[model samples]
Target: MRKGRDSKCLGSIIFVLVFCFAISALPFASAIQRQKAKIEKHEFGELADGIALYTLTNRNGLEVQISNYGGAVVSVKTPDRAGRMADIVLGYDQPQSYADDTVFFGVLVGRYANRIAKGKFSLKGVEYQLAQNNPPNHLHGGVRGFNKVIWHPREVSRADGAALELSYVSKDGEEGYPGNLSVKVTYILTNANELRIEYSATTDKETIVNLTNHSYFNLAGAGSGSILQHVLRINASRFTPIDKTSIPTGELKMVKGTPFDFTRPTVIGSRIDQADEQLRFGKGYDHNFVLNKKGKELSFAAEVYEPKSGRVLEMWTTEPGVQLYTGNFLDNVHGKAGKFYNKRDAFCLEAQHFPDSPNKPSFPSPVLEPNQRYMQTTVYKFTVRGAGRGR
Candidate 1:
């Protein structure tokens, strides 16, 4: 007809300008997914008793603040080596200064983080007692553990450029420990200056788990006291000796000439003044080593180094065991900006699962049956090796 009706009117104006540019980008992609879910619900945190607090910022300015009470972290502002940041993980700033503590500084341990000796355990055939609160041995989750209850904050995402995630749920027996676990802990802050912790959990019945995170670092800040000239390292060749009430005596031994030979990188006051007998049975290096890497993956257990705030940190874990401790009965307690916390002044690697390992049947067996799903993941990271420069 008229040149095929002008080529069908230019194909209907290029299909109506591509359907009006895809309906004008559908409200800019639903307003960028509702502004990323309102900046991830404004990074949560708004509660009192069942505590809550999640704040994460990165791009190297690294600022992490977690607190679901015992999901504890409370504060960590990495940088050092002159990059300057201050607070490196210790607690007690408010919220009644962690209400009432025992020895777990920056909380979030768990139903079975470490130690379960006399508190009893007999799974399948049924025989649980728990709640002994150490001494008769029940530690970690007994004395109302989970770093002392209170966790319910969930969802805080930003996961990159400086991560942010805080989650919790512990029903199924609450303190008596039996399941319904559901945990999630993420705290990234990359760009190299590190500060990462990632853990996830799941349970339903046949319990007996081990989760960790007892903070208490002191990269030359938090209470500013003894880390005994730092410098640690713990790839572990084997260690699981404890007694005098610190439990674990199933003996996995051999850390070469004891004092738990940190394989290579030493100097936490060089053998912590070696009076060896396992440093007087852990009045110094608490115990648990083992992490020569196996099974689940994750890798690289410990590595400290403060040297006057050149920071470092470096942990990493899929959990097989890593509990260096060194705060050695920290006394005077008075952290967070008010400072004070004397004694060894701060230290805790705690990547965990070897204190009691549920009465050690040749160790390594945290149980977790009924549908089987008890995971672990740890990462300390934090950086600055020389001339700081974090921002």
Candidate 2:
């Protein structure tokens, strides 16, 4: 009887311990599950119609908010080395404010992202004219480009990240381009702390297409201060010089010994005020650098570092050129959180084909044929510079 009682007690203790162990592990398991990617939808505001905003959050807690109105990236929250998060892209507080955004903010630019000389281009012996919104040259598609239109949005299922897919259809002769262009842009916030932009387009008629995101980034956080202190490096030896009207001169000028030389990490404002004609024309650094790439595969384009915040931004793209545009045109515009954005407050690294490609026969063609599909991918990866990694 005594032996049986001892055996029974041992069995009961084992059972109780097992149950306690399992109960203790529950919170840990729940935390692991919470680390998975997630997405949420919220009503932004009405433009001419109501619009929706989709927020994509990755495993690392990085968040990106995008809207179907112009497919704009409303905000991007990232953490610095100290693990404090802040919004790094510039934008207005309200969705309605984006409708009157002249600096482009974080919207998607399309049709012809950069410039077309004299607002005209010859395609297959036919001359086409476009809106001279920038005066003498067409800029960012036209008066009503992709940035000003609404897009269809849907959630895309992905195992590696949270994705938002936006689609738009441009009617034939819309924005003075001859095509019924169907475009799809996918914004994926990956688990690796990267915001990947995938662009694909198809057209029924032959037309010119160059699409890019115009996100003004201030790595130290938007509206906090000037981005002139940020360090920048571009993997390129040559750049396309622009004319007085901001149109490319059709020459791939060497960046060596010029203010455009960002082959090494350098302060953005170091040479911005130099007595160079190109800098004078742009009022700062606003030129396209021909990337040092061999093929159409995705390659490193540029990297930016903000020392104070220890934040780093690396860019990779399949495009042949990147247009670095300092916000020299921002004229004390009111922005989010009651902050005022002024000149040099932000910077943009737009991955795209060379400007004026439609007019410059020597440049890479931006034409898409009827049966061919246009595809482009650009990745903006965020990281932090560890201690002693300062430039």
Candidate 3:
């Protein structure tokens, strides 16, 4: 009878062990399903009425909500290593804050994105003067850029999953930028776990044009902490060194033996504190990297890998250069949940023609003439690998 009782006890132990394993597997399975769930898009308002919200969700259940107002990315929901969702891009949850924000959060900067030195550049024997919003230089479309004005929506469909097309028209002499430029920006959330932003524009007169979305990203989830620990990899052998005023000094320097070397992946804070002139000039890293990629077409520019959350952001763009800004001037702005955004709270990877390109004859020209289409596309794809498999 004792032997019989021993065998029964052994069987019960095995049954309990198998049950525990099965229970553990259930959470994993549920996580994957939640990540791959259907995406939903909801309309916030009419296109003619001003701004609207459109959300694109992924199969792994990542959702990116945007507004046609400034082609702004309102919120981005991605899964952490534990399958928990958090918004990683910095922006206001309310429309009022976005409408009255200090800096450009998630705006479609254009006509010219970055600054042009002294707010003037001679193009083809004609000198054109631009608005000097950034003191001695012009910045991000000059006061009334694509962000401040409301844009009309061209196409949007719930059937497209999470894709929408938004367009804007800038009249002549607006903000000192020449030409009546017509612009279009399309955002797509793909099943491959990527958010692609494609831009196209055409002008009626000769004018300088460079368009880019100003989206601040925080891989450890937005408002989590400083981005010093995130590993970064930029596909470039050289970078465009900047002057004290953050303007390109017309010098294309190699990244060999410098703190700017990102050929191999390294943490952002690895050399950010180095007492170098370039770092000091930027107050951090606000310089543009002249991509090693030959020809003026689409190429991979940079990548951000957050270890704790296992979230990766890969940036691919058709522009010739990519600027890496470490968010040095966030200025303790209070965001959602009263979270104060201090320095290094977010980072921006803006792809475009070199800054102050019009002034530097050695750099690529950003001028677009009549009958010519000015086109630039940049795609930011998010993928969660490692321990974050859907969950």
Candidate 4:
């Protein structure tokens, strides 16, 4: 009887311990589940044809919505210091709205990312003339650039996070260019809260190519208000000054005493309204800063911090220059969620070769040879201030 009682006691103890262990593991399992990345696709309405919108969610609940219509980053939802999630990119509610968007919102710019000087450039003694969409200069490819077209998208399997790959082919003479350029842009939302954009291209003939994403960001949340309060820092000692026509003067001017200086963290509105020539010409900041790079490798380009939200954005790029556009021409444009985006409502940090590189021999070359491949990588990492520091 004594032996039987002891055995029963042991069995009861083992059962109780197992139950407790299982209960204790529940929260851990839940956490692991939460860390799993996911992607969802939905129809984003018709624009000449059916457009698909993909939402990629990272491990930490960060979500990015992209549309195939223009490979536009429709929305980027991230958590603030208080753990409240909000969309941080400006965009329209419908795909058709993007068709008429002039501010470039969050689209993939290509062919030649920035201006091309009176829509003309000579390559190998052959001069090509493109559409002059922006008056004397040809801006963002042409009238019908990559940002206005559809792209083939496929979901890529990635261990770190969710990825979406978009491919497009710009035929020879499509935008008055001389080559059939095949381009691929991959957007990966890694578990570490980074949105990595990888761009690769191949051409059948020698041509100039500079591609970049023009995403107007308001770290305080899209449509919240102006971005003047945001602090910005650009890793650049010199910037390419622009002429009255918004073309780079081919002079790499120092940023030390100019309103363009952003070597250290400074409020965007501090000197933006100063009576400066560059500011007046652009109506605000709209020039490219010659990035301080040691080599042709990815390096820190810029950082933006929003104090109210305690959200910080760090940009790393392989490109030699970054355009710091302050949305000077926003003009009370209607945006997502019935919001109106005014001038200086947001900013764009476009990582690419200097503008009009093909026309300016002194600038870094944007040419891509037939036998060579063009590749560029840019990462936008997001984090809250004082995160994980027991703040």
Arrange candidates by lDDT, highest first: which order? 2, 4, 3, 1
Report lDDT (Cα) of residue 106, candidate 2: 95
Cα lDDT tens digits, model 2, 241-264, are 999999998999999999999999
Tens digit of lDDT per residue, candidate 1, span 123-223? 77877777776678787887776676666665554535445566677888776777688777766655555666777777877787888888888888888
Candidate 3 lDDT over 1-391, as tens digits, reads 9999999999999999999999999977887777642434455543346567777776667788888777888788888767778999888766667767757787788889888998897766877788888888888878778887777765454333467788888998888877789988888887777788878889898898999988899988888879999889999898998888888888899998999999898999999999999999989999899997877678899989888889889999989999899999898887766677889989999998999998887888788988788777788888766854322
Q: Candidate 2: what lDDT?
A: 0.93
For model 1 the TM-score comes to 0.32
RMSD of 2: 6.2
* Cα distance off (Å), candidate 1, residue 13: 68
lDDT of 2 at 33: 77
Cα shift from native, residue 149, model 3 (Å): 1.2
Q: Per model, how many backbone clashes are there?
A: 4, 0, 6, 0
Give each model a TM-score: 0.32, 0.92, 0.86, 0.92
